[model samples]
Target chain A: MKKDHIRELVVLSGKGGTGKTSISASFAVLAGKAVLTDCDVDAADLHLLLRPEVEQRHAFFSGNEAVIRQQDCTGCGTCLDICRFKAINTTGASYQVDPVACEGCGVCVRFCPASAIDFPKRNCGEWMVSTTRCGPMVHAHLGIAAENSGKLVSTVREQAWCIAVDKRIPLIISDGPPGIGCPVIASMSGVSLALVVTEPTVSGLHDLQRVLALARHFSVPAAVCVNKWDINPGQTERIEAAARSAGAEVTGRIRYDRSVTQAQHQQKAVVELTTAAADDIRLVWKQTAAML
Target chain B: MVAKTHGRAARIAIASGKGGTGKTTVSLNLAAMFGAPVQLADCDVEEPNLNLFLRCEQLTSTPVTMLIPEVDANRCTGCGACGELCQFRGIVSLGTRALVFPELCHGCGGCIRVCPSGAISENPHQIGTISVGQSRTIRLVEGRLEVGVSSVSPVIRAVHQQLRDDMPAILDAPPGTSCPVTATLLGADYVLLVTDPTPFGLHDLKLAVATARTLNLPCGVVINRAGEDQVGLYQYCQAEALPVLLSLPDDRQIAEITSRGDLVAHVLPEYGLMFTELADKLQQEVLKVAGGRA
Candidate 1:
């Protein structure tokens, strides 16, 4: 039993604009018993699809933002010019800080001429452990246009792993952020397997190659599942061959289905829809689960 | 002493504040419409999907390398100077040793900046690769960042090396207005922000437009889902004095075509006309701003 106590996480396609969240939401529903984590902290949308009920909330401090106090000193613009983020600006009378643009480097605060600028640790986002109708979900909402998505993703994944360990669940189905950038790297690292949900497109193949290479770089076993595979069967075949060449397997190929939109409109997974697409996704889930 | 003049290409960038707003779609179509002597650099290296639309045949690839800190155990004195100087807290001293997390290192040479014992040295590591290609009609360049490498700016800078003096280059930027997006739009003449009309879309749009304005780049909006939501996009563009060059309809046919790895311009000839018009408009705008010639 102890040996069977293994934690598993899954990252979808490296390409954005794909239906990664939707497919992962469907899997979350079918898992019957598993902890879900939304690792797409940069543009967290799995919460929209999962509709989690916040059971606990925690403030996340990924980094800091510089705050300039106009009352404290002269309008010396040393901090403004030195700021790599261009986060500080003069508003006629006072110098103000744009929190979103600030990279939180503290260079401005450290070298303020008047010592008026201070680097304040900001609550850039909120991480939550929630309960979904399907299962317990761990997610976070990064402040609007905030940076440090990689850190936010790592925080959410850590919480999800903790929950899975506490519940004695072997699976942690994570809806990772798209792209092979910081957030994607954070989501994919240390995962047992990655199910890359790609389409049959040039960008799809290109991104899949990068993501698969990332998996190999991390020594994680990866599987490919082509979403809307019927849209371009030729490209799908190419992706399949590429996956095989990369020493990975194609777990499933989901066809393009209009009912997917209808199910999403109803805030339901495609597997719950009374359509053939649902059946295909159900099979995809079966294979993905078996791999875990 | 002689003064030298260096000619540079007109670098244009196609970006969106939000994902799924057809940035890559617009970038490829515009590149195709621009005719010859145009280089399409897919700087969305993390997902470089423009190749899907362009169907480019790759030629040369340059690996993007960065300086990662390497600690010489013999020279390291557990001084913790490197750790203390690291603003990112990437370097940590564990008892008699120091650990350098390559992922956290920004390659700023800051760790080496404050290393007292000269234990820290620069180690060149490949973070990504930049590839040049041809899509029959257009020249293509793309950056693919190696996974697990946290930094992508170096790769983007690497992709920037393929620009020719007279060639019109279209930079396909990644979504969001972060460091990566800034890197993509650094030297661009004009930035076309492909956005939709949604709260999240609008929120990020404001951030990106502000960024473009801060950088003193000429910008305009291209609403992807024209009919779906017009009020927010139109209102924002009107308020900001940003021109709306193109508005793509939310047609499922376009989606189906794009999903099939085919460019919309190829499937829908009408979209080609739109791209041509868009390119013309951009040219006129560029001439107006930069003036006919030096």
Candidate 2:
């Protein structure tokens, strides 16, 4: 039995607040029978817009935290001296590692003279499989100041792929985090296509170029859509030209509308609302679908 | 070295959990309004937009490099000690050869120390460039990460290394409560979290506040794009006992100026007073929290 390949379309924005989540939610509405994932685990906002009802939740454990065992008190500063991150703090009688400051490098744990430190896997955060009005969605919340967001993003994505396979869904739409950092890289790999949502500002163009370059570096096909193209028509045109030069197809343009925010306030996708931007987003979905 | 001569200047980091919530805007406007010598470090290496808003006079850039391990094939013992010790999966030993993934390397120098055969040597990988310039009265330091570099904390650390401790320094952190944001928030006396009055803004602001609280840094909230309808953010601030330092209304004129790479204080002089007051309040907050640490 030959199974069809699932189309994983990632909606990414190099600059934050370029309306990636808003457009992603609308795409979920338009793309029927799709598994959606919010790969922005650092500050996952797609779940806020999608209003997913959590059916299954699991704790995500990654990285290790060093704990100084006070009972084995050597009172030696060997661990503190060996530590590179300055995570060790001297208390009244013993030294303790600041978990937040600790990079989990394990230098202190391996070098402790008295074997006083206990390196334990940290419970970073939780990820959930839930159902939304759009479809099944996978999302997560990284612990405050927790490292290894890239791992968490990969976990969410892997689970999204599983859901897509189990349900035999044809599409997976991911709302990727802003920036070309670890999480963004994790969201980009192995995806069928990356839909980069950008605006008309200079920063928008600059970041879009970088993100498109990243997509190209990974050999992932990229498509660009100007979210607020009317803000600066010249920049929008310039961005389209630049994206085309960079080998990315300009999918469509979305007009800037205040009702997009109003739609967010009402916890509904823009396509569900009565706004001009909704029509624009519909056109974007049509073009994006055609490309897929 | 310059920072050391300036005495102990407070390092104030402006951050937001959500993107496009005006972290750079607040940092730039506050830097422009501060009376004392202030250095604004745009630590958002992925997209260093603060340089766009500020006009730099004398700019000098230096490359920031991280050490990635390179295996010496002649020393050919496929002991997977280096791979086992690496937490980031930076290196993997395949039979007789070990492959190194430079992008995943945290540059912790753990592999070089752990290798028994002494097969691993450090290779300098250029991650980004740190530029120092003077914009009007404010000294500017911005980090621009090279394209295709996935890791950002090293570049952010390089930018902070250029900070002068003698004067107040403002760090414009990248959005999201992750390692890059953590690196930017490190060693700051106070953090001013900039956010708007929207659902996404409020949701991520909570995460940013939690990150500050976890780090035990004193933090205040600055509500950007404050409209009449958004009351949830204010209520959350009140409930959490986090002081609302300042609020900038959702003004189209300010947006227009910002879009044109101009500071809000420059276009409207009254906003200058607001930012100056914000700086004063920040100093007070720092003193109250850290007790003369600044």
Candidate 3:
């Protein structure tokens, strides 16, 4: 399946829970040997379905966090006064750095008169390369309350690309995080095509508009697929119309189906099921593949 | 649970480790059923939408700005101290002058503090906007992050500033167990976790609960779309002694009205008592936790 131009397709939803991960999983199944990646490192759930077996693991160190050495004890509040994130705790006799709140800005480290603060590499998360039923996959686990998700996303995307090249897969399908923020931008930056999976709802439409704008802002070619379109036909039509007007390809629509859940329960992709939802998702893949 | 307030008004943050598990739906309904004035802050700054549902006509919006280092070129020295001090490369002294990339700056004021030449200063950079409005019993303050801004903490803090100490506040946190969610949940009395009753729900709920614990915030669960509890979401709650406050049915009608941006508590009377009970349970838990601390 190797090609001169390796197509990277990232499935994104500006809003969450609109069948983003499920459809991305199905796309991996349809592609048969594509390199799969989940950019939603904070809550990476794609592994639930694909069940990737870890092959290579890498520690993701992004930025630096300040650690106050209690023994250095000048008890000066210089670090506390200059801190903007409220990360410094001035309780007891000395100050302590609340690792959860520290943004690792190095401001507190630089200004401490006693120079008691130690700037250390922050292990924000971990990204891993694995083998899934679909194909080779890459995923990550972000430490609880960790920052630098955007950096971790970028790392995962690179690992996915490397795997795609090594495995000679022509396509890489990424399950992007839900939001049009840093992580979302990092995932979709230079993709060949992006499939914006959205439900037909007011908040859905509202977030969709923002996502489309983000795609346009970065010049990423985007296609739209309405999940559970039957729940709100009028809103579906409106969303499709909006997508068309926004110069995005309205690829297809999927009706809400219990089989989707059943497939999830069995740790399988929906397209593996002989159900209406499976058929609709296959059509979506067909059209989406064409766009790529 | 730094206890942002002492028996004043509890800040209840509705959060989920996974997205689209009905955090917004639960927070809005909880506010509606509070039976008193409550502040609903949409701290999901990237995809803010409580305003979409509330549809408040009169909104006063103010841009949120963070102070980034601005070097005074005329101060006449590429001391390189500012560059050496900044780890983010926000301001790198190229031997001749310090280049300022405001976007990369975390607004930590380190470069300004470490500058020996006293050249580095602070400049406000707009990251987002906060809009204040009112809807029935809820005072809505929504944060909208300007596209292209990477950090949401500054914007989330701005939204929290609008929380009234006199009224109970419900924070609609962004999904995931990351810094953004922490920024929204910090200093809250209790965290109301909304989750679906499935593997993904339970799995991420574990992460969400861990996050709540990391902040030392007491939290309970509301299982969205609960069925026979096949996935052990209930068992997990029971095992951990985390109270299962409420279990919602997998009703398409509820989804129908909710997707249309209508409050189910208002549109469907049957669900009104459900929310009232949810509110009461939340209040009771808050009171119990407060009393234990006392």
Candidate 4:
């Protein structure tokens, strides 16, 4: 899926709330005509900043869900004993499926003696093709307590790629989810460059290394930027050293600024304002743009 | 509401829809303020850093495994039934035999039932490990998911499996309104959502509130980084009827101490009262809800 024409840059952080969305929104504004995507489907906050207007919406379906026909169910406790997910609830005369707990393994559906279980496609969430003041964008809202975030992330990326190709967009800016897990990996594939936003702390350093290792494992080139580097100068230096040792480019450092919050309150990217952090983000964009 | 099995131990889960909204900070502080007889569970298994600040002495560690199918080729009939029934494609019939992928398996056991030859059996596949430790009076239980493992619910369930019936537990839920957060909130008596006053915090907090409502759990909000500019968030909370249980200051001193991995309650001393008050309020809520259990 690697394209020679478009440069897709993904903003990621192993830890959450490290300004990934803030930085990505700035990059979108800077890129101007790029295709934007919010890969953080679990707790998507990019749309709050971009304020995209939805033009098209698509239903997302992934995996199967089990529903018991209560009228036909015999309350035999057979599915309860067989389910490992603890999804089957017997608090009533007839067994009920706790949709949140049910992983939809379909084990109970197959084992039911009366064949009372129904296996249906799970409507996990919805993905949208929208238009922001910046440009065409893609985002999604994952159903509450629903699984398959990784799948939803993939779906968003796929639609973004299609829109980019269709529109002949030369760039893509994505806001990625936190953690070094499945959803994070799903966002990494076919990405041209990864900008890892991190803060200055022990947990930040610990998680940054693990995420760097994941990037190395996937052979995805990554650049690390320490957000709020002034808060802990010592830890910031240590993190930069680690990023260097891990063969990643230490791109830029942003100070902890109140203007970042002010910008958020206005639903604008920090780069759109006159602030020290905006200058720092511009330098990051300059460096990242050169690499791309 | 589920009935409490043991004598008076309220399970309070501190969760956030947005990442880095102080779920860990709140959970750790409340556990310290609760002062012993409390179980601090780190259900955020993917990148568990509670051990970073807790610094407890390790007691025991156990691997959490999911049952995946191991096909016995010797007894195989190659009927392709296993592949046909598997929704996850964890097991596939390749030409003459069935191949099983442990990582892909949901451990549903459907393939085993579908196989006419009775060739499939289940084996334990390690996904994560649960470790128990003690920090002064509070017992710490943290779940660490294996690096490559995708399924986090099993590891979360393993951490909860270590919860004691008699002692109160403060669960540090992973950020987001997805399945993992839901898994942590399910058995809790009350959910304390910690959020900042920023617009991003308000936006994500709405999602978390919807999730708690969908799960039918009684919950309240704690606004971190509280500032005068929080009229937007305050109004939303008022409109939603979500109680603001506590609000921490938007002070630089708090951030410096917190980011340095110090429990604000222990280091600042005066701020300990906030957590103490939070504990008393949650205790009343738990007691009130315990009586109305199904």
Pick by DockQ: which candidate is best?
3
Chain B TM-scores, listed for every candidate in order, come to 0.89, 0.90, 0.96, 0.95
Q: Interface RMSD for every prediction, one decimal?
A: 4.4, 2.0, 1.3, 1.6
Give the per-residue lDDT digits (tens) of candidate 2, residues A1-292: 1135888899999888899999999999999778999988888899878999999999999988889988895988988776766778887767888877777877677767788889899889999999998899999998877774679899999999888888888899999988887789899998989999998776788889989989998999999999878767788899999999999999999997878888888888999998899999999999988888
What TM-score, over all chains together, does every model reach?
Answer: 0.76, 0.91, 0.96, 0.95
Q: What are the clashing pairs of model 4?
A: none
Error of 2 at A197 (Å): 1.0
Clashing pairs in 1: A202-B52, A203-B52
- List ranges where model 3 is wrong by over 4 Å: A1-3
Best-first order by TM-score:
3, 4, 2, 1
Tens digits of lDDT, candidate 2, B148-255: 676677789889889887778998988888777888888577889998888888888888998888777778999987886553888899999899999998776665
Clashing pairs in 3: B1-B216
lDDT of 1 at B120: 86
Docking class of 4: medium
Q: Which portions of model 2 miss their true places by more than 4 Å?
A: A1-5, B1-7, B65-80, B90-104, B107-127, B146-151, B290-294
Model 4 stretches astray by more than 4 angstroms: A70-78, A90-95, B1-3, B6-8, B291-294
Report lDDT (Cα) of residue A113, candidate 2.
77
lDDT of 1 by residue, A199-267 (tens): 887667877888898889889899889888876788889999999899888888888886666665566
Q: What is the lDDT of residue B185 in candidate 4?
A: 85
lDDT of each: 0.76, 0.85, 0.87, 0.87
Candidate 1 per-residue lDDT, tens place, B4-74, comes to 12466677888876566688888878887775568899897776767656656556887888778899999
Worst 10 residues of 3 chain B by lDDT: B1-10
On residues A1-292, what C-alpha lDDT tens digit does candidate 4 reach at each position?
A: 3367888899999889999999999999888789999999888989988999999999988888999998999989999998877788886687899888888878888889999999999998999999998889999988988884588998899898898888888888999989988889999987888989999988999999999999998889999999999988989999999999999999999999999988888889999999999999999998888878
